[model samples]
Target chain A: MDKLIEAIARSGNPSVVGLDPTPALIPSQLMPTPGKDQNTAGTQPAHVDDGDDADRARSLADAYLRFNRAVMEGVQGIVPAVKPQIAMYEALGQEGVRAYIRSCALAQEMGFSVIGDIKRGDIGSTASAYASHLSGVPGGRGSSPWHEDAITVNPYLGSDGITPFAQAAEASDTDLFVLVRTSNPSSGEIQELKTEDGRAVYECVADLVSEWGRESIGEHGYSRLGAVVGATHPQAGRSLRARMPHTFFLIPGYGAQGGSAQDVAAMFDDHASGALVNSSRGIIGAWRTSEGYSPDMSVEEACDTVSQCARAAAISMRDTLLAALDAR
Target chain B: MDKLIEAIARSGNPSVVGLDPTPALIPSQLMPTPGKDQNTAGTQPAHVDDGDDADRARSLADAYLRFNRAVMEGVQGIVPAVKPQIAMYEALGQEGVRAYIRSCALAQEMGFSVIGDIKRGDIGSTASAYASHLSGVPGGRGSSPWHEDAITVNPYLGSDGITPFAQAAEASDTDLFVLVRTSNPSSGEIQELKTEDGRAVYECVADLVSEWGRESIGEHGYSRLGAVVGATHPQAGRSLRARMPHTFFLIPGYGAQGGSAQDVAAMFDDHASGALVNSSRGIIGAWRTSEGYSPDMSVEEACDTVSQCARAAAISMRDTLLAALDAR
Candidate 1:
């Protein structure tokens, strides 16, 4: 995570690439565009191919892995990290899961620190199990294709769910990003509830995040325990950053969710190190809707454009924050 | 979940076989013996196969899965459901996860309802993602080899995490078992917290479970929403049962955790239809330490004997509950 902070500083950007591979988003050449009549158990209705359901699933997942690998390669040196949304690959079934693992492996091999955006939470022992899955400790069981340098977590089970991740991070030098203020429209329902201390529920969560990060501080003066605060609320982000000064922040809702460079500028610390703004659709499919850009653009070209846009936004955001800090 | 309740009533028992696959418990014949050199990527460690670490892990997980499949095959006529502890399998890695999925598929194929004891929780969107992964709804993406009729959940994220599951279950006609009083020693840390209303956190959770269930009551007079009350806490189980009459109870910690049949007799609704008592090690591995059995026994024999013991215990519990009701 410190490396992530430093990387953002050196690259003059605080952007993260989100690997969210939707089936419809994949290019036709990579898909089975040649035929639709080939039949087996697992063939997609849109493009039936020669294989059983398992084989079809495997092939589809392979395409996803290849697609994500391209995106990672295209975004390298431009973004700080890649946040792999686990659900999209998982929906493909076992093969998709396998593909997800392969994609993680490829990303890591290419020198990208991966953030497993799993958003998982559970009870004590079960939470420990999830931590083991993420960190890949010696005695811990489970094969996750990628042992994330950090992961996005859910703090729903309260302290019980949180402690395991903190302990695992301390022991393994990994990092965890807890969900404090999410980007969804319905987030206000529970996250905005009033606490007895006159703070919103998310504010209470922010206070807890600050407390938990106390011992996990790293060489970079930032703690491994972090929080996921949506960029949708600029004022809220400012307030949260104030509360969790030493904690890293994973800011979603950046490009696709309507957050802009200026909107996200306040999230960063002095070195552009404290925050990593994430853009999923905005980064991965930027070329699709760009003026004069056609769907006929190769997947590689489209992903390259996505990376360029992300880099520009991230740079603009960093410059804004630096100027404000110097003025102050 | 309704079918599972009907199955329990028709079988006149409420026994749930838990598939807790600890790799250390598998028999020696399996391949990939622990401490065996699994040196991958040119990295060789001298102790890949030597310690009980590898063997115990391999054997335990394999044995657990094999034992679960056998139980599914044997108990299809008597028991209603089987719960798979995700932690046990997750310790095994990719193969272990695959085995867990295989066992769930096998159980469902055998006409037994699967209650995935994952205890997953998160914020709303993420929680909805998990529900989609577990229940296999339309837009929720992830590849899981098996989707259970019901999954055990953690509700610490408050209403936001739970509402998505409720909505999905309503749409799918599935069910959920939320953690109320967990069966672990350290569970009291958060569960016992006193709310401002003077109710223990566990009680609040129980009330929430009841509230969630009210909208999902079936024609059979049971709700699709359920609660997991550890049988180890007989008093708490009784109280929670009273608070959630229509909600089904899935009680773990019945055997290895020192909970007795009589201790949990109060958990059941009429005719043992509303509660499923789970036993993992006590039933599946009974031959290991019992007087009448030994490791020399054939796998088939051990499996049959263990299944019989489980059946007997469930029948005895049912009869005891009926007798107490008659006396009342």
Candidate 2:
């Protein structure tokens, strides 16, 4: 946790680009060609060509890997971390998951912390398995497969569900970001519901995050266990910041999700080191909507422009956040 | 949901064997030999040889695949469904995920409804991505990769997080089991907290689930949207059943987790068709701790006995559940 905080401080940025690669985001040249395999019986959906499924999955996975590698190179110095939402890779099946593993590896090799955005939660043994997977415990060939500095976790199953993850993080010297107040439009349907004690569900979650972090405080005075409080709710962010003094924050909902730099300013401490504001589509696909970029460009041409566009977007976001911090 | 209810009715059993394969549960011969991969630089833990990681993961995954297939065959006629917990596969990385895909495919092929026990939750786009993955939308070569009939989801992010999954279920004519009262020891830490409106947190989530299922009710008077109420808390399960009459239940925490047939009896409707009880470790690893089983058995001997042991366990659980229903 302190390492992440220090990185943010050294880079003069508290932002992380979310590498959520979808088929549409990949360049046209990288799209997989249809496979010729014919073994389409059983659970493979009728819509897909059964025989060539593995080949196609492998192709798409490769495309995503290339795209992610490019994006990592583009955003190298502007951001302190890269969060690969596991679901995106998961959607592509095993091949995509392998791409996710490789993507995390490349990001770390490039000197950026990797946050595996896998919102996994379960009971005892199941939860332990997930924690082990993240921390690389009982790893294959004596090494963990996916090397992530931190991983996002859901707390719906409560403490026992989270205990295994906490223990894994403690043992591995990694970190955890528990979901608290999400940035979605309908998050309040449950998170904002008032409790009998006058606290909202999110507030209760924030308190738990604070308590969970107490034992894992780092040299920077922040716990490795953090809370994911979305940037969309500025007021909630402000209150949660005050409540979870020891807990760092992973603030999503920035950029395309409608959270501006000003909206997330309260998430950080006075030094602007307590939070990492994430922008997925905003950075990765910046070339699509940037003023100087054109959608009609050839695949190779567009690919060449993505790095510059992504870097520009990261710089812009970093400056905005820094300005917000300065003003506060 | 109606399809699931019908399957349960046809089998005269509302139980599902959870295929959560672990290394210990796999026969000794299937274990992967140590790999020679040396790519372990960067964040990859120093303890593992990175060079042969993929091969090792593939070996482990193949072992798990064989084990799951055997279990599916063993429990084919006795259980109405098979729930593959995604975590165990995820631990092995991409190859493990492939095994999970094949496991679900095999179970479905064997005529058992598959419930993907992937407790995934996220906001909007991410949730939609997960849903698409579940439904095999944009699957490799245009076919869905996994063939699950239903999936378990978490509801911590509120309505927005669940909406995408519900939408996907509706579109695909499948089902969803949203977490309400999870089958964990510390579930009450948040689930049982009192809301200001005089409802517990789980009660509030139950109301939301009922509402989500309203538009998707099927012929059996049950909606495709179900609730996961742990068998560990029978009283809570009973009340949740009464509260969400149209919603079915995926009851976990049986056998190894200490929930008896009598304990989960209330989860079912009068016709004994509203729930599917899941027993993972109990059914899949029955031979490991069974009376006649010994660790000293040869690998081939253990493999031969696993199916019989699994079958006996399923038959025993089925009888116990039927007796409980009859008494009710």
Candidate 3:
């Protein structure tokens, strides 16, 4: 978190680019057509006769890495961090995960903080295992498979799950963000439930998260354990800001998810340095809706278009957030 | 779930062997000595000159797979299913995940159901992506990298996160278990909170899970959507069993986790048809205390010792569980 805060300061940006690539988001020229790359890997499962799914997945993984590399090229210096949503890569299976790690590694190489949006949580011992995403190998050392600076955690299993991650984060000089109030539509089903003591479930979670971060306050006056307060809940985010004074936030659901800059403004601190707003499709997928993009473009041309569009979108988002904070 | 229920009845065992291999859990001889396996891959990061960590991880991954293969061979006909906790493999990074996938694939090949203990939760869109563990490649076809019969999911993100998994389960003819009352010491922190309506949070979640299962009732009087009720909490487990009638249960926290057969018996249905208990260290690591084990044994002999001990421990557990059910 100290490193992240410093990176944010160095870049002069309070936003993190979300690298979430899907088949739908990729250019047609980049994907391996049915029988083309299918000859590379082992045979497909007997259930399907089309081709080797593993090989196809590998091709997609490669395409995704290329797509990510282009997008990173676009937003390299404008954004302080990149949050690679693991789910997208995970859909492709192991090959997809390889791409995800490579993407994170490339991002780090380009001098950007990497946040793995892997909402992974489990029991105590298992949580320690998942903490390897931060702490690297259990017994061995050096670079970990997943080059993530921080990762998002789900706290449903209580302290038994989170403590291991916190310990790992401390050991690795990394950080974690607990899911406090997500931006999803049905998040209120459990998070907004009022307890007997007159506090919402998310509020209790906020207090717990604040406690989780109490011992690791960085020089930036924010804790290494951050909170994920969706930009959709502006009023709740504002109140949560006041409640968890020392906790920084990674605010998602902006732009494409309908969270306006004005909606996210209240989530920031007086210096506007406490929260990092994220926009995945709004930036990375911006080329899809851009007039400059054409389906007939070559692979390099399409990637260049995506790069420029994503860069423009990222810059616009940064400026919008800055203006919103200034107005506040 | 239908497949799992049938397998359980056929084997006359409602137990799933948990494959949770760790460095501490594995035999010292299995790991590649620091410099022995370092030549296979590129040099390690310049930070520490301590050999290639990736190669080390790959070797550990292979060792874990071998260990799991031995455990599976031991419990093959005795146990109906195997639950591989992905975190242990994930701790090693991508290679570890490869081992996990291969383990699942091998288990499926051995005619056993595989439950992936990946408690992944996220927003709606992201959850849909994670559902790929059940539903293979997004647009692609054929076998998934993860050969899981079912997966465990976290319900912290509410319906938005769970619905996708349920949909994927239905499509793939697989199943999902949602965390209800976990077995950890600090589980009560959030799970036991009393909502304004006087229901504990887990009960509310139980009702939600039951509702999530309503549309997918299988022939066994259970749903593809299941509940993870720890064996450590008998009273709560009994109530939850009554609460989620349509849902199946994957009970963890047995043996090494302090869950006795008596403690878990009440969680079963009248015919002992609705639940499957899991024991990881107790069964898989039984060789540690076996009189037949010797440090001088070869890898094959060690694995053989592990196999026989695991089989014997698994048989003992089955008998103990059946006796408890009979008493109930």
Candidate 4:
């Protein structure tokens, strides 16, 4: 986690580009051509397809893999980390899952830490299995294919569910970001409810996160265990930062989710070392809606244009977040 | 959900076999051989490996698929439904995901309602994507390969996250089970906390679940949207059952998890409807440790023995639950 914070400092940016690849954002050239051997260099099943559901799903997943690889390459030096939202790839079925694993591996190979935004939560053995899947088990056989530097987890099941993940993260020397105050509109319905103790539900969760991370504090005075505090709720973000000083923050709901740099600046500390802001569609899908990029571009030209837009958008996001931190 | 209730009545049992297959539980004969072609039938990637991580993952996933198929076949008539815990399969990577999809399909084909215990939750678009992945979008493209009759979802993200699942359930005439009072020992850490309004957090969630199911009531007078109230929390389960009369309950934590039939009986209605108890290791892994099942048995003999044990265990569980409900 200190390494992650140091990387952020080295780049002078607290932002992580979210590689959430959707088919619409992928260039046509990247889509697997129909009739081309679909089984080319991966563990793809050998089911015969006739341009139906299987074929379409396989092609879509292929496109996602290509787009993610390109995006990682484009934003390599500018971004310290990448958070891949697993739900987007999971929508395409098994082929999509393959793409997700590949994307994470590609990002890790490129010197960028990957935060798998799975938001998985369960109880006991099931929870332990999830923890081991993301963070490899100690002295266990074979390497985990879906290894991530950190992973997002849901806290609905309480301590028993979260303890396994905490243990796994400690053993693997990785990190965890538990959901506290989410950025969604309806998050307030549960997270904002006041407890009998006069604290909101998210506040209670934040306190526990601080406790869980206490033993895992890095050299920078931040723990490997962190909280997912939405950028959309700037006031809550500020209070949570004060309440959980030793815990880092994975700030989401930025840019297209309606969170601005100024809104999320409160998540950081005096030196801007306690948080990582995320921007998904705003950066990767910028080519589709940005001013200079047009639909008339050829496949090859569109791929190049999208890659350039992604790099430029990353730089712009980094500058905006840095400026906000400076102002703070 | 009405169909689920009717199935329970027909089977004279309110139990579902949780098909959470692990490598250790699978017999050696069913395991995928190292040299055999793994991509002969499904959409397996063509990545060549030297029997390392990828090969081990693939073989383990194959064994899980075979084990799950046998368990479903063995318990087909006795159990009203089967809940496939996605985490167990997901631990094996992409090949594991494919196995999960196939296992669900096999159970559905065997005339059993498949509850994909994914426990997935996210906000807005991501939530909608998960719903669509489990339950195919209406009239959109080819059939969804990972389609299930119902899915388990987490509710930490609140109403916005659950609304999409509710909408999907209504659209597809499927069902949903939202996490309420989980069976884990530490569930009370958050769920039992008193709110400012003098209601327990789980109680508030119960009210929301009841409301979410109002618009999706089935012919049996039960809602397609249900709640996952742990069987281990008998008192809480009883209270929740009374509070959410219209909503069905998917009760987990039985047998190996320390939830006796008596403890879970409160979740059922007078006719033993409105709920389905889940027993994973108790039934599926019975052959491994139970008497009269030995390692010397051939693969064919072992598979047969395991299937027989599963059927017998399902029957025993059914009778125990019926007696408990009768006593209640």
Candidate 5:
């Protein structure tokens, strides 16, 4: 808990980039030739022939890998970590899956922790299998190839479903970010169900996550286990922070999802480092062309600008949160 | 329900073969040759060194594909369908994934509907992606290399998570099996939670499954959507049958998991076709010399005996239930 907090405090930003490689959004140059406009997504490029499912899937995987590698490599010293949404790669088929693995490796190589946003949940034996697949490579020592440093898990199946993941994380010194309060509009359907205790289901889950992190406390003051709390729900985030004091927050819904820096900042308590605010589409772009900035600006320049914006929002929120803490 | 009842009445059996391809259970001859038991899962005969993670994963995948194919081919006419557990294949990595696709295709060709036991759950957008990935190809029509006739889903994410899967099933004339009361020992941790309304969470999920199936009623009196009610939970299974009259049941925990034929027969609800009882390890190699099956009995003979035992149990149950119904 303390180590991650200390690291984030030293870095001066609580920014975490979400790598959601929407094929349609990849820049033109990055797209394999002939597949150039194919990457543009909804826009129909002229004289373009749609490839077979396998080929399109292959290209899509390539696009995802390229974009993810670029971001991880580009933001090495800037962001604290990268969360790769498994859905995006999964939509690409086997090739996309291969690309996802490559990207995870690249992120690790670039000195960033990889949070596999898989949201997987199951019962007993199946859950154990996933725990092995995600954290422990079958016969090997140390980290597994199919493993992630941490993964986003679905807690609907309850504590038993979470136990195996927690055990695997502890063994690997990895972590889990169970979905506590998701960013989706429909999350209220189940997550907000009123419990006998008067707490919503998400709150109930938040309390449990706190308990799960108890054994994996890192010297950094953060536990190896965490929670996925929506940055979109500022008030709920504030309340959950009180319930789960030691848990790390993977705050989604920032930037393109409509969550503001101030909203995300509220997730932190006294320390500016407890939350990792994520932005996917809001950043990672050929921003110069889209924003009509100078065409001469390099990819590095665009990333720097994106980083500046994300960092500014986080920093301002941290200051506001600090002021509130002091007043209290 | 009427159509399923009729099918069971005709077939005179309620047994289902679960395709759980654990690498450890693969036959020696079918495994890659030239390797000793000390290396590469002790099953792969070839690629003794197994070399890197990629190589070991590939070898394991080959074994899984071969095993699943043989099992599907072996039990095609005898069993109603093959319930392939997705986790087993997923553990084998991408190559195993390829094998999974091939096995599903083979099963479909053999006139057997495939029940993909993935147990996946997520928020709306991602849920849709999984539905598309499992039942159809991901990335729209013809974009995926593999597709199943039906997939098992988790209901923790609530209505939004389930809707997309139902919609996908509707579009493809495919089916879905949502987890209701899982057979795992610790399912009580969440699924058994009692609400103030006096309904357990699993019961609420069962109600939702029934409601979702209303949109996909088949000509056979059954809906394409189904529920995964573990055979181990006979009482819950009986209760679920009453609640989900039109939905099919994919029942796990037969054989190796210790649910007896009589215990599972209750799931059939007198008609003998309401549920598909899945036995993974028990049926896959019942005649194997290593597993202590009579060495004199051929594999086919073993399969026949097991299938017949299942049939007799189902028929006895059917008659008993029918007599009770007639008395009423």
Candidate 6:
């Protein structure tokens, strides 16, 4: 948490780039031309010549890596962290996961904290296994396969599931963000259910998240255990800020998710260092509508367009959030 | 649901061998000898000669695949299904994931339904991406990388996270099990939080799961959306069984987790067609205590011991469960 906080302070940007890649978000020029090797992303609906399923996955994974590298290059120094959503990689099966690790390793090399948006949760022993993402493989001599500085954990299974991750994060000097209130529309169906004590389920979970991180508060007045409060839930985010003061916030659901920069202003502490807003499609997909992008451009030219557009979008986001905080 | 119910009926066993392998659960005799290619399991604390992290994961994944294949062979005919908890494989990284898919494919080849215990959940597009486990990769010509007949999902994100999985399962003629009442000790943290409506959170989730699966009821009078009600919660299981009439159950926490046959009896339907009880370490690790097992034995002999002991333990589990249901 200290490392992340220091990075955020150094950049003076409380925002993270969500490196969540999808075929639709990638430039058409970057996709492989048809009738070529089945190991590249193609515009022809990823039709594999051979009936090899693994090849299809490998092709798409390769394209995702290209797009991610472009995006990572785009926002290298502007953003303190980049979160790669594992779902996108897992979609391509193991090959995509390999790309995800490469992306994380690249981000780390470029001096950015890598948050693996895995959201994995299970009971006791299994949770310990999932915590390996933070702890690295047992006796691997400090070789972490999944190079993540932090990860998002699901709290549905409660303390037994979360403790292992928290312990691992502490052991590795990494951090974890527990889902308190999600950005999705249907999230309220469970997270907002009013409890017997008149508190929403998210409130109870928020308290638990705060308590879980109580013992690990770093020098920056923030704990390694953080709460993921969506920007869509601005009122909830505002209340949670006061509620879990010691816990930092991973605020997702800005831009494309209907959350505005103003909506996230209250999520920060007085110093504006208690939260890091995330925007996936908003930042990574910025090249989608960029005027500089042309279908006739070569892969190298298209990649340049993507990198420039992403950097511009990320800078705009940081400025907007900072302005919102200043106005507040 | 129809396919799974029929398989269970064919075997007359409401049990699924849980293919969850750990370093401790795997026989040491089957582990690779020290100072080999460093591409296999070894008793030497997995000390890699070089600093190659990938090699470390590959070795552990190899051991897991071997253990899983042996266990699959042992339970092939007796059990209708096998649920491989993904957390164990994921601990070793992407190589572990490859092994996981191979294990699932092998189990399917052996005429067993593979249930992937991947409790994955996220919002809309992300959930859709994760649904690739059921629905094959786009334009792969029906090539499904994750060869599981069914997969588990978390319900904390509500219906938005579940609808894609349900739709994909329906499209692929597969099924999904949503977490309802988990078997963990601290499961009650948020699950049992009494809502203003007087129903616990899990009960609400149970109702939602029932409604979500209402349109997908199969020939066996069960829906594609199943509930993961832990065997540890006997009372809750009994109530949920009556509550979710059309939804099937994937009961975990049996055997090694302290769930007894009597505890899981009420989870079944009147015809014993509604649930599949899972026991992982209990059956897979049975060789550890068997008289036939000896560290001095060859790999073939050790695997044979694992097979026979796993088969014997799975049979005992099936018989105990049947007797409990008959008494009930």
Compute fnat per model: 0.11, 0.64, 0.75, 0.52, 0.30, 0.64
Task: Give a tens-digit lDDT track for model 1, residues B30-61.
Answer: 32444533435245343233233434445555
After superposing candidate 3 on the true structure, give the runs of residues whose Cα lies further than 4 Å from its correct spot.
A34-46, A49-51, B34-46, B49-51
Per-residue lDDT of candidate 3, residues B232-253 (tens digit): 8989999988888888999999
Superposed by TM-score, candidate 1 places the C-alpha of residue A308 at a distance from the truth, in angstroms, of 6.0
Docking class of 2: medium
Off by over 4 Å in 5: A1-10, A28-51, A285-289, A292-328, B1-13, B28-51, B134-140, B285-328
Candidate 2 C-alpha lDDT tens digits along A107-184: 988999899999888987889889865566344443567888899998878888888899888877889999999999
Fraction of native Cα-Cα interface contacts (under 8 Å, chains A and B) also present in model 4: 0.52
The TM-scores of all predictions, comma-separated, are 0.80, 0.94, 0.96, 0.92, 0.81, 0.95
lDDT of 3 by residue, A1-328 (tens): 7898888888888999999999888888888785733453354444764246687789899999999999999998899999999999999999999999999989989998999999888889999999989877766764567889999999998998999999988877899999999999999999999999999999999999999899999888999899999999999999999999899999999988889999999998888888999999999999988999998999999999989998999999999988999999
Off by over 4 Å in 6: A35-52, B32-52
Following a full C-alpha superposition, what root-mean-square deviation does model 5 have from the true structure? 6.1
Quality of candidate 4 docking, DockQ: 0.35
Cα lDDT of model 4 by residue, B196-260, tens digit:
99998889888988887898887888998899999889999988888998989999999998999
Query: Candidate 2 chain A vs. true chain A: TM-score?
Result: 0.92
Clashing pairs in model 6, backbone N/Cα/C closer than 3 A: none
Candidate 6 per-residue C-alpha lDDT over B174-249 given as tens digits, one digit per residue, 9 for 90 to 100: 9999999999999999899999999999999999999999999999899999999999999999999999999999
Which candidate ranks first by TM-score, i.e. highest? Answer: 3
How do the candidates rank by DockQ, highest first?
Answer: 3, 6, 2, 4, 5, 1
Please provide, for model 4 over A58-87, each residue's C-alpha lDDT reduced to its tens digit, 9 standing for 90 to 100. 777777877787677778899999999988
Residue A117 lDDT in candidate 5 = 85
**Best-matching candidate per lDDT:** 3
lDDT of 1 by residue, A1-328 (tens): 6777776766666667778877566655456433332432243344322134445456667777877876676677766678888766655555666676677777877877788887776656567767765544234332332447788776645777778888877765678998888876656654665544467667777877888788878888888889998888888998887788898889898766767666677877765568888877766665455563455777666555544554554455456545654554
Output the worst ten-in-a-row residue range by lDDT, candidate 2 chain B: B34-43
Per-residue lDDT of A118 in model 6: 93
